[model samples]
Target: MTEREHSTVVGQLPRTDVSSPLTPAMLTRLVWALWMASLGLLAVGATWTGPGVAVDGLTVLMWVVVTFFSGIVHSYSRRYMAGSDHLGRFFYRLFAFTLVVMTLVAADHVALFALAWLGMGLVMADLIGIVRGWPQARAAGALARRYFVASGALLGAVLALLAWATGETTISGIGAQADALSIPVWAVAVGGLILVAMAQSALLPFHAWLLSSMTAPTPASALMHAGFVNAGGILLLRFAPLVTLDAMAMQILVVVGAISALGGKLLKTVQTDIKRQLGCSTVGQMGFMIMQAGLGFFGAAITHLILHGFFKAYQFLSVGDEIERTQPTTDHESSSMGVAGAVTTGLTALAGGAVFVALTDKGTHFGSGLVLVALVVLTTLHAVRSVVGAASVPAAVRFVAVPLVAVTAIAGYGLAYRAVDVALADLPVVTAPADLTIVHGLVLAAFLAAYLAIERGVYERSEWLYVTLLNATQPDPETLLTSQEEYNEY
Candidate 1:
């Protein structure tokens, strides 16, 4: 291999290697200005007397998340990638991506949304391939480009059909004019758009690019996971009224998302590297998000988008930091506590459902609300179990801790649900149908069964699947971790 090919970081700050004129100071100032502008526009969006703008509470919330997280990523990358030859260009592309995302969320016109949607793909291409000379990074960029281009075309076609149906080019105007569900052609358009979302979201057949993303810098990977992938769901939100008009589109999303979610979860277990594990996690998370959109919980999906962005972004940027991490060690008595754990989480969810019923007259989303309660319960159970002490620990303490954690998680879910429910009341987004609840329940049960199987050593005994996943996901330690050191020697 050539000397330059092996080098991951450049040591020289010589002006000769600079690709773009962007400096640290300039990027910092831009971030500040971007946040300030987003906040101001948010207020305007809420109260603007304009007929074309559709800035709702959810939009404002998403804008804040995108802007705030973009700033965090920019600052972290500036330091983490301090010595890259294309450092200036790197920040510039990230900035551009941030703007495109904000525009995608902010625009109420189909024309503007289309432009921003495609622009995001273009910027993501550059951002993902920021390592420039690396062939693997370039290939990842190519894959991303292919998905984004196809997504953009499908979205554009959907928009054209919408405009044709209602003679309205603006998001709110079209929704105001169309009874799209009655029109079979428009229903077909929405289905096409769902395909676009599937592609853009890295679902199943399209998910390879997401796994290949470790070639990019950590900040870039974080941006894709936390911010970029959510763009697909956001796009769905924009056309949700029409999207909900089609049953086939909904079925497509549910089936594809379920498959992708299951695949991602299974792949994650066997991956040897931390970053690959996170990548698989994202694939699974995005699948669930798509499922949320399919179920008509557009608002809930947006909420997930923002929360997951914060979570995965924090995980990525905080890598290698001196954060306290809990390691799992099983206790003989802990196995016996499974019944208690189940009781705590189950009661917590029941309480959450009760609260929802008491507070809201319109239970338009009982199914999704119930799912939220279950998720909170599951998370709390995991957290509590991870920290469970030896059998010697006081029974009273463990009992108290389990319920307390469950209640806290349930309460958070309830509050977030109520707020989002109110914000999205006018939109068509809600829980899935009653019949699908059984399907969802069965899926969750299966996931739990798999978890127990793995915890109980089923996976360890399965040598073929375990070895195959490890081989596919484990990075070359010498090339990845030691490249910079070796380059320094050279």
Candidate 2:
């Protein structure tokens, strides 16, 4: 060999023994073959006779596409870093694994979902341990450690509780209908686990983790918040039969899901940062799915789960461009927008809390008087917050005046509907569920308005944080690059 070639070989990083493990080509070919096999079966199954087969088969196909794309991206990322140091190699491996597991999850096949979940959990735990063992003062490492620890702890507690509950018949049998016989312990446990995970997926009160986890890079956030986060809601829908068995749990699921759905929508409207907006939107979308499940609309929930996953993944990708456009340009970064314009932007928040309370307590029923009062009060408070918190005059007017105008119009319309029904009624059917439901539906429409307002506020706060806070809170250099352009630009 030439002297220069010998020097180059000797100077390479110490951990350059790429030959010990399976070769890249071998791994790639193996994964590619499996992916193709899954896709082929999915296509065949899609045309099968049964309704359930069509749904399940299509689900399988969807996941195959997700995984196939994820694998391709991972491969590209890996090859780009192939000649880098040991640390680069390690990260590429992790990124690739996360993508593959996420793709497996999207497929929505029960067996594959379980296998991928367990495998990913183990991978995350191992990564955390490895980082902790290293002497590096890495903030990203520290954040990852916290994430894995919290995630594992939460999952462990639920699993243990489930195991104990499964051993006892009392929890399992309590929800059995009078006509039906014993229910499976595993079924109950699975429902409970999914519910807990769904909550932790950061819907409403559990949302702190989504913001905190921003310490991670955009890609990780994209995968976790935009993609995998949807799993919790889907998981619950998968166990809809078991969830319905427990009436109290079912009600809680419905109410909480409703609140989360509205809350998430209200939060997303005003956000400045692209990722945070997407994160809050995910929360809302998941809430909607959970609501469908709670209402015994399992088919709809599954449909939503599949659709939202695709849309959210696309949104996350688009957000990268938005983030790039707003990024600081120098040591003293120029602002993305002028202060006057920023101040003038009015957003409606608190709309969710108000609208949610209103619909639940609409007083359409004889016994719901107190519920109505509570809802009215909550709505008033929302009006107060909107007026007081308004960034501009038009915003304040819309927040306060719009709802008042809406409520007045709804009550008047309801009275008119009732009067007309009564005036025409002595003849045929005076009272019907359809008529009442129609009134209730109108009331529900008002609540939807309020939900939009609340989401606007949430989006604003998120935008503020993303634009200002995230920029200010520089990540630790040991684990993250100073500029996204250096590592992320394709």
List of clashing residue pairs for candidate 1: 296-430
- lDDT tens digits, residues 225-246, model 2? 5345655654554344445555
Residue-wise lDDT of candidate 1 within 431-465, one digit each (tens)? 44323456566656766776567557676788987
Every candidate's lDDT: 0.69, 0.46
| Residue runs of model 1 more than 4 Å from their true location after superposition | 1-20, 40-54, 177-184, 246-248, 322-386, 389-397, 422-445, 448-452, 464-490
- For this target, which candidate reaches the highest TM-score against the unseen true structure? 1
Which is the leading candidate under lDDT?
A: 1
**Model 2 poorest 10 in a row by lDDT:** 426-435
In terms of lDDT, model 1 sits at 0.69
In terms of lDDT, model 2 sits at 0.46
Model 2: residues >4 Å from true position, as ranges?
1-31, 46-66, 79-119, 122-191, 215-218, 323-447, 451-490
